[model samples]
Target: MIKKVILLGMAVFMTGSIAMAQHGGPRGNKRGMAKDLTPAQLATLQTKKMTLALDLTAEQQSEVLRINTEDIEARQAEHEELKQMRLENDQSTNRAEAQFARQKARLDSKIARQEKLKEVLNAQQYAQWKKMNRHLERNRRQPPQ
Candidate 1:
């Protein structure tokens, strides 16, 4: 009877282990881990003054705001699509490709935005803006430790 009980317990334990393994983790929900931002939302967040650090005249500010809003929406849409591709692909190579594409697009967009911003600034204002952007970039790059 004791031997039979031991065997039954072992079978139950094995079945539970197999079930857990197939289900993956306690939560078992992929939706929570997926990227959720729409392009419009990301653009709105990006155009906010805290991140841009530019000093502008009223006209310059309006122009910059328009540029930022447009750029952010475009980039955010591209980013969201890339993120969806990454999530759908299980292969590391595919994920890497998606990431690379997303990064390239982002860099190109940033360069384009910089050029547009230049058209909106005088020499002194542009210099100040560059300085502020450099400071912001430096701050962003620091390791949290």
Candidate 2:
């Protein structure tokens, strides 16, 4: 009877550990994950980068902010609509295909917006911005110390 009880306890403990591991385990450090920036913080970052890169005037800054705000709203709406669609259906091949299409469309829209933003910059500013982006991309690819 004692041996059977010990075996049962071991089985329960093993099952619990497996279940926790499947769902990102207790050892995970969720606190170290990047937190989403607030809208104001995002606006500040955008304005600072645009001002530095494009030498944007007050009027130009306002226009850029308006464009960014519109883009963000549209993206958020698209995300919510996609989430609703996903919730309404169980996972299947068709849903997976639709999700991929939606993600591709989102990426294409972002690229188009980036191109439109380039149109707003002067030739010199655009050249400088491109160089800066290249530097940033290179730095991002390097291994962290």
Cα RMSD, each candidate: 10.4, 9.0
Candidate 1: misplaced stretches above 4 Å?
A: 1-55, 90-96
Write model 1 residue lDDT over 1-145, tens digit each, in one string.
9999999999999998888777664566443443475545544554456235555567776677688778866865785676776687646566567679778878898899889988998887778878878987997799632
Which residue pairs show collisions in model 2? none
Question: Whole-model lDDT, candidate 1?
Answer: 0.71
Once fitted onto the true fold, the runs of candidate 2 whose alpha carbons sit more than 4 angstroms away are 1-41, 89-93, 134-145
lDDT (tens digit, per residue) of candidate 2 on 102-140: 889888987877787787777787688788777978988
Output the number of the lDDT-best candidate. Answer: 2
lDDT of 1 at 43: 46
Clash statistics: count for each candidate: 0, 0
